[model samples]
Target: MNKIRIGVLSTARIGRTKVIPGMQRAKRCEVTAICSRNEEAARRAAEELNIPKAYGSYAKLLADPDIDAVYIPLPNHLHVEWTLKAMAKGKHVLCEKPMGLNDGEVNRLINATALDPGVKVMEAFMYRFHPQWVETKRLVDQGAIGKPTSIQSFFSYFNADPDNIRNKADMGGGGLMDIGCYQVSLSRLLFNAQPRRAFGWMDKDPEFGTDRTFSGMLDFGGRLSTFTCSTQLAPYQRVNVLGEKGRIEIIIPFNAPPDAPTEILLQQNGETRTITFDACDQYTLQADAFAEAVLEDKPVPISIMDTFANQHTVDALFKSAQSDHWENC
Candidate 1:
């Protein structure tokens, strides 16, 4: 099989530290190029990552005819712009999470992809591709958890740096946009339903103009989900799914260790057992999934429509926080 030549759109930390290397490990994915705003920085990354080519600007990378796909790890606000541009250039795209700043941007992203149905576009939610989660879904489907009725998630990391982009409101910085997004996506996926309404409360950072702490509840018809996502709390994360018969718990739900084995706690019939997953790189899994989609003409796993629903729920949560009432999603 011919390898998919993938271009790294930016030298973002996630790209440099995790995703690019994972792409290199993925089957049929070649990390052929790296791009950054600074030519020197791009060259430095190219040398460090052992990429053959480097481009000083995103446009240059897009213009390269050799690139079959692009992994975009740009900031939250730039996701829509670069993804649209990359897809327009006939390049399949795997863009990082919170694919847009709001529902409107996601709608625009959907429209752009609709205009070019042949091009594959996916939101990079790496955790979804992990075997642990896959097994968890299988268990749920097989009624190990009976009928899943509710979910609760917590994702938090203490970050008070005012200079960080995650603290900048204009850059789409905030706990909700960063980590809460995962909670929302997880809830929807586990429930297999979109939220009908949402309620939220947030505490803003005075200096950063971003939410330091955010908590929200999502109503999925007969089921309900709640989450707390924070950038000012001690680092920890978990997801719990409750059903009529039993409950399922993901210990390191979101930021799972790439090199270490992980397990899920299953409690049913008054007994508890741990299901272990061998150490696996979800980033690599994500890359290979995208490569498979592009190379074999299959659909991208996480569709823009799903992203729109996630972002729409996020938007509704924020709106609910402002109005101090449940907001329709």
Candidate 2:
């Protein structure tokens, strides 16, 4: 079988630490080129990652005939721009999540892909690829959850630096965009419905004009999901699912180490059952799936529906926060 030749669009932390390494370990992906706005950084990353070539600009790397795919770990705002650029060059694109800053941006992105037949575009969502979630989703759909009632989740970390992109309102910064987004995405995954109304409160830094904390509720049909996403809170990441039958809690749900055991605590009729996935690196699994999708000419099992739903909910919440009341999503 031929390998999928992938170009690294940026040497960002995700590329250097998680994505590049995962691609190297996957069966069907080859890291052909890495590019950076800074030539020195690109050269350094190419050397460290053992990639064959380095380019000083993303445009240069995209023009390389050997690159069949491009992995974009760019900022939230740059996602649409480069994904379109890559697709225009006849390369498939795997972008980091949020897809884009808002629904409009994602719509524009999909519009750009309409003209291409050989290429495809997808947003990287490693959590859904992990066996834990696949099993959880199966159980939920199998009536283990028994008509989901309400959900509570959070992704919080203190990024004390006010100047960081995560804290800048202009650059799509905030707790909501950073950690909070995961909660919203996972909630939709559990509820499997688009939220109709949203209400939220955000605490902003007067000096920076960006939010330090965000707490919100999404009304998905009859199920209401509450989320706390903040950059000021002490480090905590978890997901809790509630149903008519019982409840469950996932600790360190998003980024568990490969082969690291993950617990799924379930409660029903005052009796508790604990299950564990022995160990899995969701990132590696995610990379492998993307490669298979390209090589097999198959559609990804996970769809853009939930990704778009999450983006819609998040966009409404921000608008509601600005309006100081509930907003129709």
Per-model TM-score versus the true fold? 0.99, 0.95
Best by TM-score: 1
Q: Could you tell me how far off, in angstroms, the CA of residue 235 lies in candidate 2 after the best superposition?
A: 0.7
lDDT of 2: 0.83
For model 2 the local lDDT of residue 266 reads 77
The parts of candidate 1 lying over 4 Å away from their true place are none
Q: What are the per-model C-alpha RMSD values against the true structure?
A: 0.8, 1.6
Residue-pair clashes, model 2: 2
How accurate locally, in lDDT, is each candidate?
Answer: 0.93, 0.83
Displacement of the residue 131 alpha carbon in candidate 2, Å: 1.4
lDDT tens digits, residue span 1-329, model 2: 56799998999888899888888888788888999999899999999999999999999999999899999988888988998899889998888887788988887866675566557777787788877788777777777867888888888888778657777777777888777788787877877777889998999977767778899999887899998888878888788888998877777678767756888887778788988888867777887788888888877555555566678888999999999999998
**lDDT (Cα) of model 1:** 0.93
